[model samples]
Target: MPGARLTHEDRGRIAAWLADGLGYAEIGRRLGRPTSTISREVARNGAPVAYLADDAQQAAGHRARRRKPRPSATTSDGQPTEVVRGFVDEFATLLAATGLPRMTARVFVCLLTADAAGLTAAELVRRLQVSPASVSKSIGYLEAMALAVRQPAPGGRRERYRIDDDVWLRAWQADTGAHREIAVAAQRGIKIFGAGTTAGTRLGRMGQFFARLSEQMGGSTLAEPVGYDALTVLAALVHAGRPLTLDTLATALDWPRDRLTAALDAIQLHPAIADPLVLRTTEPETYTITTRPDRLGPAQRQALEDPGHVR
Candidate 1:
């Protein structure tokens, strides 16, 4: 029932319903159709005030007659048929409606539905019937967003653009990265606008919302919450190249002692960083990063302690 075409009787009922001042939702409810279906029907077949069932039915017939007939057989190289091409265009239009650039959406869809080997720019250009420049620009945009990647075509200078199996995962990660950036920028705005001011309060709420969203989407999957402050502390420690006392870190970072302590605690708790690189507590309450000994074999550790023994 969902995908079934609207019958002539259905169109006549829609016209009568409109005349009776029934909204799309009520009309859809009575007809057991989706609200969007009713809305699109009315929009394309002349709007509510001007809608006539006879005229709308006639237009629908004309449009169907103009549509290309699908072939019963496949092409020589197993390329997409006319019907599949039509579907590609329709799907691309839906993707574009969701904020992706039109050309980019088309290119992305083309790559998505392509063979596992993928498609070269020339192939994409020929398939989409667009200029080389349009294909090139769209591929660049897709690559930048991690939605597509380029692999070398066998025995040729041409590179194939492919939608990886993990493309959606990469895209989700990129979106979460954008959310974190927005949260950070909003936090900065709060500082600039004065914490007690109306603007600052607005920014504070916005910052908190994005921050929570980012943590919910990105942080939960990770070993621990590695936020901006923790990252800043890690960067400072990495740059310092030696152990540093808490007072020294406070002075170098210009952060409150409690804030620095919290960041250090987070860094220590984060297993992703802790495995390859460890957060160490040195003498006199100093902190430093070192290789996690558990990651290395005993011989490897000994070799590092006495490099001459390796030979």
Candidate 2:
């Protein structure tokens, strides 16, 4: 039984050991399997964070039963043979770290390693030797994540799945809206629970985090400024008693997102003009003016107007 496949119980022990934060060497000592075996098993299943003993064991069995002769795939170094297998294993492992299912990662790697035209479902099924259902499910999941795209086969009705240069970028862009939604929901929750309460306070903090995150997304894309909109926004915030969300500020001031942002940018650049302004407090991402009034001298205060009105 030197090279025998691992038993189900063995896998359970592996999972427990992993949960206990044991390294592969320690787990291998406990399981009496080579360290390489345990490492490869986890890599092909779902890496450490998402690995489930039962699922990994099942996948291992499926792969074992489906094993076939290797193709003429070459390594990145151009050596012929199955050296690309190791790269595929590593790629699948890293993909799982990003929250992709192991099966989905495997299927994605298969397409990535395919010819320029990509592969049909039938081809994926054949290449991975997984069930047609498995290929279909993986394709669907990748499609939903924007990590893969599907198109018609060149001369056939069958659809082909492929990943392109911007697959990851598109996936990141897709989540930017989700970040905006989270910030909005959290901001709304602040008033409902009353910011003085613990729940309201937590919501406010969360609102700030998501708001900053959403605003900083590269895909959010900043806009050019047009007029003295920033001055109006400052006046509105200074007049309002409590902190306000960007959305609320935009509506109350009747300024567009870009203009509001530009105004805030202007105020930030000239803190003396709006030295009392604070973007975050107990309520995150919400804007409020300081309760204490003007520390700025007449000259500094006069300079404030010049910076307050953004170009």
The C-alpha local distance difference test score for the whole of candidate 1 amounts to: 0.79
In model 2, the Cα lDDT at residue 169 comes to 67
Instruction: Report backbone clashes per prediction.
Output: 0, 1
Instruction: Write candidate 1's Cα lDDT for 1-311 as tens digits.
Output: 22246778889999999999999988876664557779999999888999999998898899889999976644335754555556666787798789887667878888888889999999887766666877898899999999999999999999999999998888888988898899899989988999899999998888877765765566444534435677777778789999999999999989889988888877665534333677889886799888765457798888878969777
- Candidate 1: lDDT of 55? 91
Cα lDDT tens digits for candidate 2, 146-235? 888999988889988888888776877778768879989987898898989999989977886775565456323323342255556667
Candidate 1 residue runs with Cα over 4 Å from true position: 1-80, 223-311
Model number with the top lDDT: 1
Lowest lDDT block of 10, candidate 1? 218-227
Kindly provide the TM-score of model 2 when superposed on the true structure, using C-alpha atoms.
0.50
